[model samples]
Target: MIEIDNISKHYVVDGVAIPAISGISLRVEAGEVFGIIGVSGAGKSTLVRTLNLLERPDSGRIRVDGSDITTLSKDQLLRYRRKTGMIFQHFNLISAKTVGENIRFPLKLAGEYTRAEMDRRVDELLDLVELGGHRDKYPAQLSGGQKQRVGIARALANHPKLLLCDEATSALDPQTTQSILSLLLDINRRFGLTIVLITHEMDVIRRICDRVAVLDRGVLVEEGVVADVLLHPQHEITRALVQESCPSATTGQRLGLSGPLFRLTFLGAVTYQPILQRISAALDVGFNIVEGVVGRIKETPYGQITVQALGDAADPARIAAAFGEHAVRCEALPS
Candidate 1:
């Protein structure tokens, strides 16, 4: 596990102090995918960099597995850094080096692996990222997604326990983005590696993150399980981010319905069940679905539906109780 304890950082320029991140504290559990999201100038990049001490915080402590990493000596820091790996948004591969050479770079730096051992590890990583055939190709010869796959292979070359992704998919198209996210998810599940990624894309978090922390202008505004934060956002920044990904999830006012409207949330098996139909019939009330979105957050299936009740007999309390019985949540919305 990783613990960030009230860390803050600032920079001085032209004799003026500008805050980058202030008193941000959070934890990342072992073997889980955690995401940090924010807009530009929100200090997301600065926060993620603090995990590996690339950007040191001016205050507070960073602990990994109960040991404070902030005060490590230079030699100790080097040894500690070997256990962590980071990938960049732009594929930071050497244009002159072959894919296999790039993957072997970290092992060569460690000075512990022999030539044969390094070769074997490189081959294994190539297969892991599905880049076996591209081993002999240079970075300039590969496509954007392929280059990222190579970068991922290189990052995993040293068998790091924690993987850091800094907007790893922002440079790819939507289709390529999905593929890269799938590969990352597969890696996380297969090896139980802890992943910490920073991105501006809500869809990226919705697809792969188990939990998320929202950052705005250098402070942590909200943090929770991916499903909770996405479905019912409490912060304005979070709602706007979710709105960009799925507008229907954020607002139901576009329908302009006359009757009472409600936003219903279904989770897991409840998403597949006909709970709304049964409740409408049993309560002698009719419902009209104004807008709906169904998808999965990581592995859990979820759905949000904006519905309008036909009769004045629809009691909000009773409706909530009925849905609650089936592990669903019913929330009343404005007309």
Candidate 2:
């Protein structure tokens, strides 16, 4: 488990002090996959780095498993870091070393095993990452996904309790990214490793994160369960991310349509309900459905549909009111 209290960070650019993160607090439970999402300059990278002391906060306390990591000495911090592993967008592997050598390098540096033990551990790590046959290949000889597998194996060489993933799948293609995410899920299930991931892609968060926190301009904008936040986002930034990730979104402005533009987000069992038909039958509202999308976030099915209410007899407000608390959203366009 990890707890971050009132954390803030500032950096000097040229001659002026620039704030990267300000008074952000978060708690990540053990064995939970936590994601931090934001656009550029949102301080997502800075926030994740602080989890492992890669970026020291100017003012705040960081606790991991009830231990205040901010108070650790240099040597103590090094020892603590062994339990917290990290992977990056770039593979960050030793170009000169083979895959097997790269995985074994960590144990060699720690001086914790004999030659036989190192060989056994390297093979086991390779097998765990499904790269056993390519262990002898160099980084240059591997594909981008293979290189990332090597990175994952190297990160896990120490049997870390927590894994920090900094845009880990940003460099891979969509198919490769999915494969890597699947491997991470397996790792979480098998090893019970707590993971903190930072990414700009909402799809990445939806695929694996148990919970997510939205950040913008170094501030915590929103945080909650993936399903709750995805279904009912409170912040504009969060909504923008979700909307951008929608597969059926249209171009240009959405608010200037002839009819009222509405975004209907379906949550829980409400997704299975035929509320749209019920509303149409009960209320004098004609629905012109535009964008309809369905996807899963953390295995929970979520859907959003954009619709336009047409004709002079339509009453959008009355239609939204029909749902009460069931399912409803209506935004009147400019006439």
Candidate 3:
């Protein structure tokens, strides 16, 4: 639903151009959750802001469902933005407004609904975000998670076709973050809304993103399915991000295992099967797991294990072939 083509953005400081993002390009398919991840100052926020034209790129085109948003007229852009909603890291609700008013604010601004209609829509959004009982509460009276729920309810007030989340859950605790992510996922499935979110956490991407793009120093370093990128990261930056989320999966060398080490990747149904035990028994080889991680990427179960094959008869190529027959990927790792 969203296509960003060779977009570049820069800022002028002391009459010199400082790049925020350069030559970044990616796509977000309809009804999917796409995540852009990076460390601080990696231009993740800058890239996401460009989607809503909050920060217009210095060069290149941004097309949403086939229309070049970069070239839209001011009036046209205003109308376009109404169909796209944004949620922020810090809850951007009006302090004086109650939860109900905060949600009603968007509908009021759009001038597309009557007073009774806006009130009914506000109630529906409140219920959707599970804040029906807290509608009368002010921002100062709510918890961090509650405030964010209000922010989400307000973002969805106008029934946006696309949602832009800029560090939407970064400010919350782990439990709260998971709750918010679950809500976003439900929203995506229920409304078929396309979502583009930016975060510095790999765990967030693993939890909800269908695809992810890694950003580093204003460059698009890597991009792919969450399962593929998390299991076998191709870029150094991507590996580091994955390492932060699952240390054992990336730092197998630290395990201090003797003999030849191989990294085995299991996906889908194979992740649940006793592939290693079966392979070991069939080959008359003993398998010692040095380090391992088993978890799901979105809804797909996967496992990445670092193991050592024992016994003199255990040929590396032959052992790898045995695992391959069961739809497992085995790669020799440095000991």
In model 1, the runs with Cα more than 4 Å from the true position are 249-254
* Residue pairs with backbone atoms closer than 3 Å in model 1 (clashes): none
Candidate 1 global TM-score: 0.97
TM-score of 3: 0.98
Worst 10 residues of 1 by lDDT: 249-258
Counting only residues 3 or more apart in sequence or on different chains, how many pairs clash (N, Cα, C under 3 Å) in candidate 2?
0
Runs of candidate 3 exceeding 4 Å displacement: 249-253
lDDT of each: 0.92, 0.86, 0.92
lDDT of 3 at 113: 96
Candidates sorted by TM-score, best first: 3, 1, 2
Better of 1 and 2 by lDDT: 1
What is the C-alpha lDDT profile of model 1 across 1-335, one tens digit per residue? 99999999999999999999999999999999999999999999999898889999999999998989999999988888888999999989988899999999889999999999999999999999898898899999999999999999988988889999999999999999999999999999999999999999999999999999999999999999999999999999999999898987333456656667788999897899899899999998899888889989888999999888888778888888888888898888765
Question: Cα RMSD to native, each candidate?
Answer: 1.2, 2.9, 1.1
Clashing pairs in 2: none
Model 1 per-residue lDDT at 205: 99
Q: What value does the lDDT take at residue 102 in candidate 1?
A: 93
Residue runs of model 2 more than 4 Å from their true location after superposition: 247-261, 278-286, 309-318, 321-335
